[model samples]
Target: MSKRDYYEVLGVSRTASDEELKKAYRRCAMKHHPDRNAGDATSEAAFKECKEAYEVLSDASKRRMYDQHGHAAFEHGMGGGAGGGAGYADMGDIFGDMFGNIFGGGGRGPRRGADIGYVMELSLEEAVRGVEKQIEIPTLDECDSCDGSGSADGKLETCGTCNGRGQVRFQRGIFSMQQGCPHCGGRGQTIENPCGKCHGQGRVEDTKSLQVKIPAGVDNGDRIRLTGEGEAGPAGSPPGDLYVEVRVREHEIFQREGDDLHCEVPIRLTQAALGAAIRVPTLGGEVELKIPAETQAGKVFRLRDKGVQSVRSRRPGDLYCRVVMETPVNLTSEQRELLQQLEATFTGEDARRHSPRSSTFMDGVKGFWDRMTSS
Candidate 1:
């Protein structure tokens, strides 16, 4: 009998991606699996046919040949056999790939340790300027007592269940699923006598102390990866990485926005009316800000190159200082009398000329009252 097209057999299109082909093959093969449809010859034949289709399509070379020439590409035995493509002959390995990532067991060897994340808090000054800090973190470390072997007399026996393979296969419905051996815990060996310190785990809880260098201009939420500094792997495998995430505490003097900094500069009422050069606080230090004559409240003054310079962008930003007029408080009788005398000097059109905003507001109030009475 002539064979059906591989794409048709697996119920997938020729342009299907490798992942799509695998999903299609998995569905078709499992539906017609011999184990599921026992004593059904049609289902068994369908299963074998789908498996053959998957084997050919899964191999890049075989897939290219099959795509160009169709079934006639392999008219005789095969250009390449079971070794070239995981055909129906190797059900063990084929099913292992299909079910591995889904169930977490495959031909790939042991896994490494889990990565760890540590949040490091820093002040605004420390973040802008680089600093080195010594940090201590609690994690699993290789047991010095057992040399990470978990065996007490430096002796281990092959696991009876997995037969030194570290994985065991079991029939799950129509599929054969594999997982790490319970007896060996994926180590392929069992301890004759467990270590007293780590018990048979090959690792123990320990504190790791190291000096970490935080680069300058690192903002909040930035992370620094410390390679191979994470928890020790299970059974002496390669360790993982440690990530240090930076958290910048709020500053009292300045508010940082991207590279620029903003701060409030308070000046006396007399200084706002007349002119005065007042000192303002910055991240670096205090700087002199010249207030122009008759400078209004909330007037912003830009200081060039006075803000933070980020690590990524080397260009420094400007500092914006908003002038806040300070009202005199708790004045003595003489001071109150002097303020009253100053207030008396301004009258009528002269007061209007001095405070245009206040004159515009009174005019608006008059207009509003006129409109209300008319309505």
Candidate 2:
């Protein structure tokens, strides 16, 4: 019987992408696998057929040859297969060549090192105005003994098991499979005598001191990146970066919102009732604030340009100071007598003129009492 078309056997169109072809082949292979369909010869045969179809159609050069000249391209040693026949061995070699690279095999070259992060705590003052700090970090550095070669005396030899191919192939029932060589660990080369310093790992753990410059106006959770400061990768790979994360500490007296500073200043009751000039603390130093007469408690006073200057802008923020009037306690006997006399003098005057709120409250109380008596 004549063979079926490879694309038809894999159930994919001629224009199928590589990913789509792989998905279709994986689905068909899993569905009709001989291991899954035990005692079913037809399903096992179909599985092998699907594997064969995928082996040819998944390759660009093989698929082109099969499309133009059919299977005859491989009949007379014309194509790159043993005896010019599309056998399982040839198929396994092709699959291994392509999929091995995808799966981190066949000496897939050096990989970049992993990036690391460190949380740096900063005071509110330091965060507002940038500061420089030195920190110590523990990381992996390239071994200096053999120059990261993992070989003593800087000597290496080809793997004997895989003949320097980094992989080994074996025949199964109706298919062939390729796997990484067990002896060489897929490196294709082996150290005759391993380095004593890194123990053949090609990297060592060491602590490094780094100076980090934090920019002003950086808020909490901000990240500063230092290029090529992270751990070194294996042997020939490139080093990674180091990331510094900022965490601002809480202030004792001030609360910051964006670029502004807010604080509460306590004032005596007399300072609120009779005007006075009070001293207020700012980032620049102490400044005098004038409180007007009859100023109520919980009043906010804004001091312009007394807050923080943003890193990105020339204009500075304002400082808001909220006044909290404090009541006197533990009064002396003479002070108590003076307060009593003041209260008596306030009652003798017209209550409406002296205390408008008290006068209005007393009038309401009198009206309620008159209504109750009449009822």
Candidate 3:
């Protein structure tokens, strides 16, 4: 039979990270566990399918091959060798080595719980100053009723199917396939009396509320890890961690580049021509910016230590204020006449001295036209 895509089997995106893949597998395994579904054959098949998918996707080399060549990469001597003969990992081995105890009766013992990821969005101000937030995540928590035993009577019996091996092997056309026991759900044990709250599974769905303290100067894409704050693992297994990823929202006034802050400061044409001491807004507060006489548009002024203090580096950065010259609008008749009189006076040497860039551009254009005409 043709196999489904590994990412599709695990119910995750193709770009899923290792942590995300683990979390997806954890959910799939718990949902289709034999203990929970008992006699359901469909869930058993799904459990095995997901297990096979995870085995390939979790391995870095195998996943790379699978991504590049699909299932052909692992086919018999397709790339170099049989994908399953030596390279393909069995379900028992997956639970035994990498997971280390996810299957209850395995020699490796139970696997640690899956890690969780959360993105926290903050405004520019909140990110710069730091903030405390209480977040609630829906996750699997240890059942309070059964104490993670999944049994009301607290009694368990060895599974008759695999005989506590947690896995069973079978022969397929010239090849052998090993998978977790369907009857016992790979736990190698059966619950005599299932817990009312969590069915046969040791964990229950619940919301976990936690207070997270964000350190100051945390930038976008920064992550804060909270130990043992993820989903609950099987009994006796250690829990995973929670990674809170920071996403800073766009600021209205300022744009941050590393530790430096940049902003546009608009000024009137008069201010640019005749110098003025103008107050510009900064993150800390407003500061006076001196615009020299005959200053051109797009002039940048750097203020030391006015940007941000990065969490990684103790040294503060500078804030650059780019000046934008604004032209006068909605001119009055008297003001227009006064400007015309000033324009009439700006001729010959005066125009060249005052409008040096404009004079140079005009001279360049005149020379280009002269060359074209001469040619």
Best by lDDT, which number? 1
Among the numbered candidates, top TM-score falls to 3
Question: Could you estimate the TM-score for every candidate?
Answer: 0.69, 0.58, 0.71
Residue 342 of model 3, lDDT score: 84
Per-residue lDDT of model 1, residues 194-246, tens digit only:
78777666777789998999998888889999998998876677788999999
Q: Which of 1 and 2 is ahead in TM-score?
A: 1
Mind giving the per-residue lDDT tens digits that candidate 3 earns over 1-375? 898898999999999998889889989988997768988999989988897788678756457657977876445222211123443335434443543333222332345666888999999888888999999998888888988878888898886655665555433234344444445545677788888777756787789999999988889899999999988775425678999999999998899998899999899988998999999887788899899998999999999999988888867889999999888899999999988998999988988998989999999999999999999
Off by over 4 Å in 2: 1-108, 156-192, 312-315, 344-375
* lDDT ranking from best candidate downward: 1, 3, 2
Candidate 1 lDDT at 226 equals 94
On residues 1-375, what C-alpha lDDT tens digit does candidate 2 reach at each position?
Answer: 787887888888989997778779878977986557878988978887886677567655456656876765434212222222345656776666665544323543334555778999999889888999999998878889978778877887987766676555544344444444444544667788878776565777779899999988777788999999988865535788999999999898888887899999999877887889999999888999999998878999999988878766846889999999887899999998987887787755564676776778988999999999999
